[model samples]
Target: MNDKVGIVIVSHSPDVAKGAADMVRQMVGNEVPLAFTGGDPGGGLGTSVETILAAIDRAWSEKGVAILVDLGGAETNSEMAIEMLPEDRQGRVVVCNAPIVEGAVMAATEAWGGATLDEVRRTAEELSPA
Candidate 1:
């Protein structure tokens, strides 16, 4: 199996996160590790550190993980989750600043192609508006 950079999708809405992940799978297949988190543990529409952490674990890889978040709150919570990881993992994970859906799709595509973390991040970030 290929050990491409992993990916995590974060959103305030669970449905949105799941849909983005689904799109990634359809577009890139499952060669790259992938996970997603959204909403609070209480089932409300908000970001959650716990859920984000869990998603990170699910998508963890020595190749590292690239996170795509849907909103400010999701990004903030994703940062918190990254801080909570071990030092080794902390350094490898990155939160990409790009559109959640499009970014995730492109990020996964890069990862599946064996791109490095930075390359995958750039692939997603390039999707952003100038």
Candidate 2:
């Protein structure tokens, strides 16, 4: 019953994304697949579509993948990354509209528990304001 789903964290600051990923890893241990992408290619505060895409690829799982982003641009770039995926792969990827840090922690924990993608996304989204 290996029902683990993968997670991808995207943020404008590399440190923020990495830190959140670290926290999630601490929470879920190695039971879930996690990847993070932050900052521009030049190492400045910005998100990159390519980086996001790569992180998604690194964290790819048969169960599914959920993405959490910090801000509007991060969300936009994440959408672009998903779009760039092949048609077959795109359906399994979801961009979650939840707070990056909290969402990553919640999603990772749910995935570790063998939750499906919808269940993990719901767990993360439940933390957002109504």
Candidate 3:
């Protein structure tokens, strides 16, 4: 596992993804690397598959990257993004189970240095509101 962990949140709109990232930063103090994808000017509505993949590449450049996505188009975008990663790095990317807000917070706050994907996943699930 990589010591540096990255977060990628995808949603139907940039605001949703960025909002999720913002929430995580609020808890974790912006120490962790996080990226936003899904929407932007001229980027079209719904999840941005290419944009998400690009963000993942950048995030993974520094460390491992995990992905969390909103429902519908975001889910499809995430899946496509995962497929785009190199085989070895693919395992480092995860689609979180919890909602974007809770999942991003759990992934960011709980992802200590050297934390594995399993640990991150567990934390996200554990921290998610029931």
Candidate 4:
């Protein structure tokens, strides 16, 4: 994998997550690893820990992964996903406290510039809170 940090978009609605991931990919290209997930197991509007975990896996990078979530529930599920990862991998994934769509784009842009995990996270967080 590339040295750039990865990006994961999480939202309660599948369409929102997919749209945000699409925007990031359009702007950042394939320079950074990217993945996204949303909705509960039944495909309703709710976050899923399992889906978040899968997104993390798809976007895995040795550098780290930054997850941008749409709401508090998404943040909570993202936390659970991070906790479920191996001890060595847990800290490498973080749930960013920023708007999902804007934050994902910003974080991905920074990651494309070869920023570290913390740098990408800070870039996302610096935006107005979601």
Candidate 5:
């Protein structure tokens, strides 16, 4: 796996993140790395920063990583996650606002082929009509 890509999804509810991850996994298979974060502050519906950060690390370890966020806490959570990542790995992570389904599908497709984080993000942004 000289060239590989990883995925991370963040949302207001863990269900949303997991659902998106599951769909992407089904589409792309289990070969590549995938991470998801969501849930409420007091409830167990969301993952801790450590969990998300670990996933981010694993994703970055390969080729690069792309992060997709739904809305609400997903945005703030992703931003915090990026800040917590090691400085060297910062460039490997891209936080994008593409729709969960379309963005993830496109990102996973490119990731399966080992696309760079920037490439995946650019593709996602291009796909986004917003």
Candidate 6:
């Protein structure tokens, strides 16, 4: 089977992250690799670089990985997570600046369609809340 790009969702609320993941799964079925990290390590309203790193690892694919963050520190933590990856692999990951829910859906669908990492990221970025 051809390896497809994977998706990671980051959010300040665990429920938001998980809910968005579920929606993406419904949209893409089992064909896409999907993972999510939300809330703090202590189960509070925040994000952790470690958790984001683990989620990225879970969604890792040779094709590449795209990450969508909800808000606030999620973007920062996601960037840190990507930076934590080895230099060789860091370029394989992208943190998208799209709304988490919409971006996750678009990214997962693009991945399910076997799009390249850059393709998936572009698809997600094309989505506008306006």
Model 5 segments beyond 4 Å from truth? Answer: 44-48
For candidate 5, lDDT tens digit of each residue in 68-116? 8776566677778788877887777778769876788788887787777
Q: Please give the distance, in angstroms, between residue 43's alpha carbon in candidate 2 and its true position after superposition.
A: 1.5
lDDT of 1 at 43: 91
Q: List pairs with backbone clashes in candidate 6.
A: none
Pairs clashing in candidate 4? none
Best by TM-score: 1
Candidate 1: lDDT of 108? Answer: 93
lDDT of 3 by residue, 1-130 (tens): 3365788888888778778878877878666777887674486668766788888876673446778877877877788878887798887788887788888887877675546667777777775667
Whose TM-score is higher: candidate 3's or candidate 6's? 6
Return the candidate ranking by TM-score, descending: 1, 2, 4, 6, 5, 3
Q: Residue-wise lDDT of candidate 6 within 35-125, one digit each (tens)? A: 9989998879999999899998888898989999988799988898889999888999998879899999998888988899999999999
| TM-score of candidate 1 to 2 decimals | 0.97
Clash totals in order: 0, 0, 0, 0, 3, 0
Worst 10 residues of 5 by lDDT: 43-52
**For model 6, how big is the CA root-mean-square deviation?**
1.3
Model 4 lDDT tens row, 62-89: 9999999988899998999999999999
lDDT of 5 at 99: 87
TM-score of model number 4: 0.96
Worst 10 residues of 1 by lDDT: 1-10
Instruction: State the lDDT of candidate 2 residue by residue for 1-130, as single tens digits.
Output: 3468999999999999999999998877977988998999997999999999999988989898999999899999999999999898898999988999999999999999888999999999999999
